[model samples]
Target: MFFQAGASMVENQNADAILLAGTDLGLAFDGHDPGYRVIDALALHVAALTDLATSGRG
Candidate 1:
């Protein structure tokens, strides 16, 4: 699930997420460029997954 906002040259589709390699830019740069919206979305998704996992519905 790798989302690159500008990497695609197509005009009709887009990526939903991105999985960058640790060796590409190190952990310090992880998600830093995505800013708060991306972080918040990820947090919400994580929280929902956690809830589902804890409830044995995942």
Candidate 2:
């Protein structure tokens, strides 16, 4: 499976974390465990935007 391959790559490369920036990539690692730390770039962007939009709210 892709997850296994990814996990293997992570282990091989000794990556601290994986960046899932693309929508499809995000979909691939969203609910499944990939045996490593994964950062959803889209989620972080959305969170930042949401916080900015709501920052002025009372």
Candidate 3:
């Protein structure tokens, strides 16, 4: 409920996107929506790392 309420509050304030910066926040938002754009930092980090690994640019 804490995460949901915070996200809703941010959305109410007209935020373009709510960032979930904590890695453990997935527990609160994995399959949930707070009626706004939510960017999960951990997910993005993982995606970037995966892309870099596959890009072979080392």
Top of the candidates by lDDT = 2
Best by TM-score: 2
Q: List runs of model 1 lying over 4 Å from the truth.
A: 1-39
Writing each residue's lDDT as its tens digit, candidate 2 over 1-58 gives 7677668768898878878778788887778877788889989988888998899862
Model 1 pairs whose backbones collide: 1-17, 2-17, 2-18, 3-17, 3-18
Pick by lDDT: 2 or 3, better one: 2
| 2 versus 3: better TM-score goes to | 2
Q: After superposing candidate 3, which stretches have Cα over 4 Å from the reference?
A: none
Off by over 4 Å in 2: none
RMSD of each: 6.9, 2.7, 1.9
Instruction: Give the C-alpha lDDT of model 2.
Output: 0.80
- Backbone clash numbers for all candidates listed: 5, 0, 0
TM-score of structure candidate 3: 0.76
Model 1 quality (TM-score): 0.33
Tens digits of per-residue lDDT for model 3, 1-58: 7566667777678667778799887668888766777889999999999999999974
